[model samples]
Target: MISGVTLLDYRERYSTKVYFQKRFFTVYIPFLFWSIFILFYSLILGRISISDLSFASIIDGIINSKFLSFYWFFMPLFAIYLSIPIISLIPKNKRKTIFEYIIGVFFVFNSFLPLVFNLLKIPYNSSLYIPVLGGYIIWIFIGYYLDRFDLNNKSRKIIYILGILGLLLQIVGTWFFSYQNGYVDQMFKGYNNLPSWLYSSAFFLFIKENYHKLNFKGILSKLISLCEKETFGVYLIQYYLMEFFILVLHFDPYSISYRLGASVLIFFLSVFIVKILHKIPIIQKLC
Candidate 1:
């Protein structure tokens, strides 16, 4: 028979392992859910409103916007807005060839963008993609460390504090110092400019604090999981739907309310659209 002390130790070890597994999903689920909503809108621009039709025109638009941007400052997320979710899919321990990793990072960073800038007449911030994707990748590495390594409380606290502080600095740099010209004001430069580091830090901590309390089983849980899965589909296509609203409603998308309205309304509608598309065989690939 097992000794009492050994049995208790085994039980504690098992509990800790179980908790780590749950925490991993907790961080991922919320990030993925929001990424879907943003991705839908990005795709709409690429699919429906593309007018420039050339890579040079897109680059020209970026330069032109910086100099003589006559349009009101409006920031809509690009599909790379889903970076946080995308990185979650990168397996932590999977090693890559040097060339493959470089290509992987490059491809991940530019997934929905090169097409958008090349095709769409719209010109937004150009360089903001770096920190958005970079910060997310960094967070994934951080998440891996927190989960995979044996870190003492002191080490965790130091990392947590430094991460928070660095993020604050990045936010300050984006808002008051660097980053401008209407590229998703959520990034390093724009109105309410904040760095990806700041945003990701807040997101990471928010899930860490709330994951346990969230019911991961039940009807609502399933609903949220569905939402998370739909993020990319919703993100890529929602903006196309919004373009419909833009043309028909004559809504001044420059206004904050309009953007938020676009984001909110597009989310559920895309969710419904995704569900319907899933039922069809041929269109499932598009979704």
Candidate 2:
């Protein structure tokens, strides 16, 4: 969604330096602040001992997002942001064809072929290496393509149905494999996989198609805008709030009821905290 939204507002004439500067302050600064904050919070909660702390370890934690598992998202997100200027440099007339070819390559090699190899129990070792064309960057192009083009009703319906099937595969496949292994299987649960791509694409299209039909007005719209502004800040801090619930409050997140309640509470609490932080001039920029 971030990539799609960014593309919506992007212009080739925009200054790369200014764009990077804004992202550095708005995204990276908050990431750094929360990384350190979470590290200290974990320490205070006895999640890690004093001996585990070192300058090197701290740097590694921030760089690799080892402090909080969810923080790993920032690294790829920043990478994508860094690539946007280059992405924007693609010739306007040739962008559609180039994006299509690249997306197809990503689908075949990075997603489809890997799944096929894994399912067949094949020892997959590809000599063909295209690091820049692989990983979550595909999503960036996918988002751009989907936003730029309109799908007909038939196409949308097919995509929606496939998305439903993809979701079912993730749920059922994971449960089956996990039951056999006696542990949760993460194989079916990553964004880079086909199932996730289908599910996410369908969801994105659904929102894009129907958004105009929905009524958002007055205070409701303002509230929605406020929430949108706080989203990144909330994401940066929400993991620690969840950890506090699990570790300090002993909330069992595995329980459906507890999960729902905790999620709502954490969301509102994080929003409130971010809202308060936004009042402070310097602190607001960091978060």
Candidate 3:
């Protein structure tokens, strides 16, 4: 197999010199930038807002709220994107496949579950903490599968077909189950829209396989490269900044379009901030 901008190989993790693998950088970078606007808009507009206080209410509200329902969906994907690099930091001896690293990340976050369960005064499922952590677990694995398309062409074709079929089945199943009430009351609602997991999974798999074969090393590639490199800083500040903006704009988050716009604005802002902070000795850790 051809070496893709050799960095810290899984077999030889944590080398003296740090380098980004070409496999991940180009695709991840552009996707991250695109996600900011897409996810934010969905959050603010796609689903209804989480009512808090009850796990049931949040799930229900998310299903009802256009933007809020979408927010729950984003949690799984974006959280995973945020965590990949951190997981890569683990020693090679201790780590195995990217899936193992993802589990480790989940366990690290899951460690806090006992505390969250005890401290939070709410009904069952009121504690939505574990799911967010689980989201990280899901994405990193997706990245691994994406970066290394070892699967044969036939296998990939089959997988894509199955993913689509599974989603279609899921839609039918959910629709049937949802008739119990006037509406479905779970954050895990809707389908055939932007950021569809089944479609994204298929697309990522397809890209991973053909990425090297494609023309990705040009100006557009460099632009994406920057986003991938700056993503950690972007992740660190995005949600915090989003919250801040919510207060500043005095705008209710239920507006999906505004939140989407804010996410796009924040994506560029994060890159500029990272450039400045890289100069500072101490603040680097915060980003």
**After superposition, which runs of candidate 2 have C-alpha atoms over 4 Å from their true positions?**
7-9, 128-130, 216-223
lDDT tens digits, residue span 1-287, model 2: 55745753466446777787888888888888989988888799898887988999999989997888888988888878877778887886787899889888877777777777877889667755357775588888878887877778898899899889989989999999899999998767889887898889888887777775653555556767769878888898788788789989999989886678889889989999999989999888877
Over 213-239, each residue of candidate 1 has an lDDT whose tens digit, in order, gives 675556556768779656656754565
Each candidate structure's TM-score, on Cα atoms with residue i matched to residue i, is 0.45, 0.91, 0.46
Candidate 1 at 94: error in angstroms?
12
Task: Please give the RMSD to the true structure for each candidate, in Å.
Answer: 14.6, 2.2, 12.9
* lDDT (Cα) of model 1: 0.47
Largest lDDT belongs to which candidate? 2
Provide backbone clash counts, one per model: 11, 0, 15
Q: Whole-model Cα lDDT per candidate?
A: 0.47, 0.81, 0.51
In candidate 1, clashing pairs total 11
